[model samples]
Target: MKKFDVLTPIGLVVGVVMLIFGIVTNGGITGFFSFIDPASLLIVLGGVIAGLLINFPVKDMKHIFTVIKQGFSQNEQNLDQLIKTFVTLSERARREGLLALEVEIEKVKDPFIRKGVLLAVDGIEPDMINDIMSAEITAMEERHRKGRNILEKAGEYAPAWGMIGTLIGLVLMLKNLNDPSSLGPNMAVALLTTLYGTLFANLVCLPLASKLALKTDQEVFLKQIIIEGVIGVQAGQNPKLLEEKLSAFLSSKERQKAAELITSGEALNDEA
Candidate 1:
């Protein structure tokens, strides 16, 4: 199922506000179109691309599209549902033993959870299971860092390129000083590069980088929950005790919700 995210809408709203304000301030839609200088766009965008190419390998550069797609996609982890599933699994393992998890592994959707359960069913030591899962988590973190880093570099380079475009505009305007009337027009055209750069950096690249970091945090937090859940299962922890332990990951309000789940016997019912 797809879930709606507020990030994209927030970004779009902010962008639309800037667009409308710019058009109105510049004396309507026609004047706003005058701000569109192909040369400025080339300088800002081409320079950003050049900077990215310099800072990251081509393989890493390829991930920009993937990151954009990921930003719009639904968050993969459903913590509440995950907790219930873990509790159910823990109760079953406590009763029928780890071998029973073999039949249930096929029913698990998350590959990470399934793998951890399978490892336990195969009698791997808890420490070894942790070591393997921790390594996988570390690898996931590194991949996310790579993507965030690319957007960060783009944000940094954009403004510098914009300044470069401003300088180029100044030089050209000065060179055409013989036509004094044309100077202001030439200068305005040059400054448009800086405007483009600022807009791209502040509105597009920086926000995207921040969003990617937020997404990374959510993913890592979810994975940590899974890791803890799997370890609790392996050690034959009581379902209620395991729930209490996992509840530590939530906030005060969320903890209260979990407590209600326990008190209302909803968790016990799931175990049954």
Candidate 2:
């Protein structure tokens, strides 16, 4: 299951608010308007976009928004629930045989788990199943890397474009040296572009890219657990031993939590 990741939006809003607050505290609300340089914004934003277009293919560009969206959501990995599921599947397989798991597969939501279980049921060799599933994991990692590369490049482009905007403003200011009145506005444009670029890169692009990478790592970890569980089931390992093997993947804290959940579940079952 996926849930909205509040931290991304909250962090962005906090950064903006703090920036606005800093401006207001230093120069008041009216002074905040001085920072709004449309031309500077256009230069930084347009330059970044153009650089990305040149850097990546059109098909990849189309998925940029989708990649960003992934940063705002997270997969809810309940390790306890996942372990319990595999344990149940293991027991059923040991009791009723591998073919019986076909009915149980319908109750499994994750396509990866379903596919692995189905492969086992089909009597595929354990080595072949591991090879096939491992290949899928590799492909998934590659896709994530591609998506993350776009954001990483965007972060890199933002600051460079800001420098370009700064140089442009500087040239313009130098050209209008005689016009004392134009100097302040031109300077403001120059400084604001750098600010915008730095803020966009640090606060948005780089952060989101890092978050996506972390999420990808977490997902890969979960899938690895699934792979082990599937393989254990196919091998007809003792359910108790399989649970112990899978539980090894959890941290001490997670093991404690899983134990608590298992105890509670068993209590509920006894009561029923």
Query: Model-by-model lDDT, in order?
Result: 0.81, 0.89
lDDT (10s digit) by residue, model 1, range 135-252: 9989998998998898888999999999999998899898998989978767875799888999888888888878878878877788888889889998999998998888888878
Residues 147-254 of candidate 2 have per-residue lDDT tens digits of 999999999999999999899889989999999999998898889999999999999999999999999999899989999999999999997788789899999888
Instruction: Quote the positional error of residue 41 for candidate 2 in Å.
Output: 0.3
Model 2: lDDT to the true structure: 0.89
Best by lDDT: 2
After superposition on all CA atoms, what RMSD does each candidate show versus the true structure? 3.1, 3.1
Off by over 4 Å in 1: 1-6, 256-272
Model 2 — TM-score against the truth?
0.95
> What TM-scores do the predictions have?
0.89, 0.95
**RMSD (Cα, Å) of model 2:** 3.1
